[model samples]
Target: MPSKSPTPGLKRRRSGIYWCATHQAVQAGFRPSVARLPYSLENPDHRPLIEANCQRLQAEMLQFLANGGREQPRRYDGTIQSLSGLYQIDAASPFRRLKHNSRLKDTYVLKLIEAAFGKRALSALRIADFYRWYDEIKKPKRPGGPERVRRAWGVIKKLRELFAYGVMAELPECERLYTILRHARFAQPARRRMVMRLAHVEAFIPQALAMGRLSLALGTALQFETALRQKDVIGEWEPIPAGAKRGADDFVLNGRRWVRGLTWADLPADLVIRKATTKTGAFAAHDLKLCPLVLDLLERIPSEKRTGPLIIDEVAGRPYAESAYGREWRIVARAAGIPNQVWNMDARAGAITEAEDAGADLDHIRSAAAHSQAATTQRYSRGAVGKSRRVAEMRLAYRGLRNGP
Candidate 1:
């Protein structure tokens, strides 16, 4: 079903350790250990180094195999040798180039593993050691907070996967650290909502505008009105040229006005967002579709002398970060007398509710939201209708009567 990797070999020279085809073949599992010389006797110091390098190499090789290394040539032998030296496991091997995508994530995991178990051979690490490291990291601190601890746990989990592969490949002992931790997991309490009235939405928009936070105000209002994600607004916005031909920059509002719209249209339609992007690379136009109200809001935004971003910081005219925008939202909400129930995601929920109340079909709402799954659309539609107290009461009554109450 698949082609096999060529064998790996190593060469021992006075200058440094070099790979030979014979050793390569043995390392790749194609040849027996008898094919390579017994380093245990001739180079006593080299034996420990070689063994340690072998463990690390085995881990990297397994990962390479799992990833279906068809995209890149198999170069695990050189990479393992280099990483071993870099981490101070062995310094005799030449440095190797790391695959660009794997380099960042791998480096982060390796560093964390090393810090937790300093100078310990990769083979010597136990499940308990990993647990100890995780426990130490989870300790509450004044500056770092729970978020930092979560990041550490995530890195540890990824590293564990890498190491576990080596263990499975017979290079090292398998440690069930993550499984042990899972059994001790505690359930986090759900957050309670403090509901506020919808009229607060109207008040917030004006205040944000008064304070020169038009983008924040309009963005938040638009989200509530259209059920668009925050990234849909801030990340994606094309400026409507003062006077230009219709293109990606133009949008139709109220069946009359031609305006620009904020949308993720620039991104590849199939692009999956694994992380946040900065203002310079923030919005992709391809992932967004603008509603009429969103188009109207964009038309109202002053395009004259607008340079940095369509959505800018109220105080500084710089592009707004999600966190900064979130903070501004709180301030605007408080100013609008909605000190409670002003959540970031509530806009999306509210829009769904509004559409459902207007008797829009599930398919229509799903298309508007750009949801891929019909189940997700069903969930939103069900939640939107069931959220009303009157509807809930009616449903309960209907169910009771149907059950012969």
Candidate 2:
């Protein structure tokens, strides 16, 4: 006779145990003990062992039938629910390791992971299941073309990161998880950085401050000169350092809870400043030289506020959030008749361009922008420097024409 097929969810291990691998089976104050499960055929009196295990298995099956064949999914052993539970605890927790902003994105991406697999057995996930999910998410693309896929790319990448973390923490099947998560691929595009004109920035700032949008006014001013990100300029979720003198530039920004943005000490000098926390996760300070406009803006800030964050939310008495600050910037942009094509990040690109126009060398622009590679600095300063080279070539062409005649 052909070998009998094993019942669904039943599993056997080399340790001579027949595991109840069934989902949502009630225990009724009685956890399944090893004695209640099947033993190996090699055991002494193996027939009796098989009979007893069969009797217990029958009893559970009858109970499942009486209970309408479905039990509540609990945080059982070796299930995704259990994995998610473990993820929320211990020193290895993702929340603890990631910065606040990054943590927020991770939290959402993790929710997507949990929503898909939370009720499923952790040991049961396969590469095929990941492929199905990937196909489902790839259907829609916005008119912006890359934006939708860009976000999906982040989600997919972050899902891989979660599993990678699981591997370090030694969660079950982590190596397998890594392979499956990577199988779920999404493409990210090479996006061009938008640059703004100095005239557009000039028209926007005074209107923003006049409208009591202090965050927009101050943040734009700093980003335009320092070529810093909004988080680096607006002091995202950082607190003043402990037991430090107030109203002084030397006051530290070492916070107990979070410290991922511009701190007071990050801007010790008025003209040239640096950041303790940066996007690259480097501990060393990244220096930036302030222009006359940036310097003037720095001097106008209240001493009490200055001693706290490099930039503070005057109304909320906290740091300005990315969305809230973006809204304020839009309002100012509209009031100043700036085109809708502008973004806060464009200011940094414009700043790099300005450095090029002022004849700052490539390395100088690279340092001012805090970019890791000179190529990235060149990319931002492309238009200005390219034009200068063109003008020089044009001058040579004119001289050649006159001399040839």
Candidate 3:
């Protein structure tokens, strides 16, 4: 028989390398009968002569398939490429490692990663981006503030690890990215670090108490004043009173119970604040005792069968989540005529400052705050210490003049 014509169904083309579109295969060598094989864009077996050309064609094919053989979707390939290439190097890749190894929650970190990806290319990002992001985020209406920037920094640092010690060891691009982010501007305006004052706490408490939303307001205030974290507040029940001591000290609301006392025994002894396994991962739990004022406020709240959370939403009947409490605390502050500028942590710092001003020893204040280190407590007491020193100098000066020295 005459040589059989090439199979009618198998279409062959040989512009560069022999390719069989009909069979979805490509020839490895010149032989017509060479084993027909499927193509892989990423596979190294293709012996691609030009890496860029191969990558471009592979990307086009991917786009063709992704678009269902229609017109390419706008910006889809660019988004994917940006995320997988540049963003992978600058933020997303390291964020993934952080999520795996750190206490931070994946959702929070992922959100930040997405933000970074949408912000700008790693090569194009400047320190100004960091500052703008920080400022935009710190607004009362915004979801996060300096705390978020701090957490994002952690995520960014984690991203740096991919270049510092990993398969991408040869990539100098990562080092450049790190150098840029290191000088990145914060999203919020940078404030000179100042010591917190007792007046700050004294100013906020009465207003928080007057809101009639004592459970949440008092809970938040207590966390701030006592340096207790939200989790620490949620781990124990408000104490209850038995007999005539009930009205004398404790009060019942909605059939629940609470007592007014500030001691280790009255609080959850087992509570320990550590880095949260949630997003942000900033503050953790601690064994914080309520101040007397916080106890008095708690006494006014109605009791409930649920005693686990020191602060619970009476309407929702659930423990206070930090985000929700933060929003609610702002409302309470506004209603109580307090400036909206004060934050929960600021309140805690204010308490420390107040104690220092009152001559409380640094060690005692540190213990009361349950601070892990003395230096952190000292930050709160710095103003008090400075004032004390000035007062001593003045006393000496007056004494010397009186004695005609």
Please, what are the lDDT tens digits per residue for candidate 1 over residues 71-100?
Answer: 123232312232223332212211123322
**In model 1, which range of ten residues has the least summed lDDT?**
87-96
Give lDDT for model 3.
0.46
lDDT of 3 by residue, 1-405 (tens): 211332221222221222222222212111111212223334453333223223333444444444555334323222313343332223324543442223124323433444445444545655665556555444443455224544545455544443243224333345666566556543433442443344544555676656556675566556655665444554322313223245543334322343222223344544333433122334444433334555566556555432444555665665442245667767766765566566654655666777777777777777776676779878755346645866898999999999993
Rank order (by lDDT, best first) = 2, 1, 3
TM-score for candidate 2: 0.62
On residues 1-405, what C-alpha lDDT tens digit does candidate 2 reach at each position? 211333322344432344352334433322231221334456653444354334434454545455576432323376664565455433556656665556545544555555556677757878776665665555456454533555556656765766676787777786788887766555664576567878987888888778877667767877886677677777554333334345533322222122355666666554445454368753333334426656666667777766556666566565554356777678789998998888777887898888888877778677667777899878786368645776898999999999996
For each candidate, what TM-score against the reference? 0.46, 0.62, 0.48
Model 1 CA lDDT for position 399: 95
Model 3 scores worst on lDDT over the 10 consecutive residues at 26-35
Between candidates 1 and 2, the one scoring higher on TM-score is 2
lDDT of the candidates, in the order given: 0.48, 0.60, 0.46
Question: What is every candidate's alpha-carbon RMSD to the true fold?
Answer: 16.6, 16.4, 18.8
Query: In terms of TM-score, how similar is model 3 to the real structure?
Result: 0.48
- Relative to the true structure, candidate 1 reaches a TM of 0.46
Q: After superposing candidate 3 on the true structure, give the runs of residues whose Cα lies further than 4 Å from its correct spot.
A: 1-172, 179-189, 192-210, 234-290, 301-306, 381-391, 394-405
